[model samples]
Target: MTAALPRADVAPVAPAKRRRHALGWLAVVPLLVFTAIAFGLPALAVLDGAFTAKDPATGATSYTTGNLTTSLQGPYLTALLGSVKLSAVSAALGALLGLPLAQAVVGSRSRALREAVLTASGVLANFGGVPLAFAFVATLGNAGVLTVRLGLKDSGWDLYSFWGLVLVYLYFLIPLMVLTITPALEGLRSQWREAALNNGATGAQYWRHVALHVLAPSLLGGLVLLFGSAFAAYATAAAMVGSAVPLVTLQIADALSGNVLVGQENVALALSLDMVLVAGLVMAVYLPLQRRSARWLDA
Candidate 1:
């Protein structure tokens, strides 16, 4: 009788917990496979190609620093500079525009205005490539309706110029910056503002002492993201300005699609090298921003 009672007191296995554990890992399996096949393999290919170069005379592929060095020469350098400059300007403009808009959105008493701002931001954030290009062209291009309506001479403005590219890039970039930075701004509590006010601090002083400290890291991160987005953009520039602007992405696309550099693997290698250098620049910006973000969050 005692042995039978002991047997009845034994713990039952948790089938539900086991089933949940199995399902969780099963869900992860597809994602793991997708990452390996899609992102991992291509990334490996790029890494391999970046290091190895084909011999022009023998048509044999081998590793060489020369190809990478040649890749860093004049054209790539010019394009890299242009791309960086364009992206930096776009990010700066976006931040400037975003800050005020974010402030308004966060500070607004009207629910309608906040909803409208959010909706507008969503639409504009996804507005890129050909459609954005055409939007800019329509507003600023020679034959555009706005241009015709304004009766401004074609010589008064050129939407295909480098400045024009900056403007067009900013159109989409500003909304993204707002979306990115607004969360950080809105996350900040009203207590900080009230405390600062109670301490006899001016509005500017409060912003500088409290708000800026809290938001600086996130702002920097958003700038990095924006800069990267604009730097990597190809279609907007191509559709609006063409290769006449001399961006690194344009160079790569030209190598792959058009004359002089078409089907040239070496040039592609060079283009990849150019891309690496730009990537380095982006990382340089991003690392410091991340460090700053960590510090702010810790504080």
Candidate 2:
């Protein structure tokens, strides 16, 4: 039997709309190209290096999982765990401190003050790495001005220690959290507060039951962002504590430099693979929470 005739009455998408859609997709080409070059190629390189090794005597290359296995087995494991702990602590503290600061900024009567705080936060969030490390060391290091004035050295406060590195991480992390959570704070409607008050809900109750509930997703997303930021950090921690801090980033650098053992560059790439996985997992959690928060905010 002959196939059924085509539906001649079917409507086609408008040519204008079709052109607009094509343009939209075309507009994304640059971003896709940038991602391919910036992230994709680098990722492929890391994966390739991570699962392969070169024979020193014969100079022959072969694929193997030994790099990953070795990465997870020894001091490498300690560095990974240390980075996780530092990221967790710093992210938690940043969220805790930054949330209230953002709230205060959002609730302030002074517009100038709000803008100033936000601008400062924007600046400070990007203010990290070697300069940040140097600043912290000068201000909080053993012979730092504050250290000398406060006698922190006598108090056993060391700026090159794990906790001191965490404290340095906070310098950027808190500002980052403030910037991240500010928009979420502003999205909390004033009408909700008024209605809660009209119903005899105290200020604390309104925040506890109403505002906090709405802001939870955003807060968690911001926390995750803070976590990823701290986790992937390299320069600041490297500059601040060097080998004193048992961090994955530093370990990667060490492996690349063959500081501990010769011909372990593949192990460095494996460590990088581990870091990418951790960061990917954090972003996986963050993206969903970010979307959820945006939906609530739009509501």
- Lowest summed lDDT window (length 10), candidate 1: 3-12
> For each candidate, what is the lDDT?
0.80, 0.93
Candidate 1 — what's its lDDT?
0.80
**Per-residue CA lDDT of candidate 1, range 173-236, in tens?**
8889888887777778788899999999999999999999888878888888888888889889
lDDT of 2 by residue, 109-180 (tens): 999999999999999999999999999989999889999999999989999998898899888899999899
Instruction: Judging by lDDT against the true structure, name the best candidate.
Output: 2
Off by over 4 Å in 1: 1-26, 280-299
TM-score of each: 0.84, 0.94
Candidate 2 displacement at residue 52 in angstroms:
0.4
Candidate 2 segments exceeding 4 Å error: 1-13
- What local lDDT does model 2 show for residue 79? 97
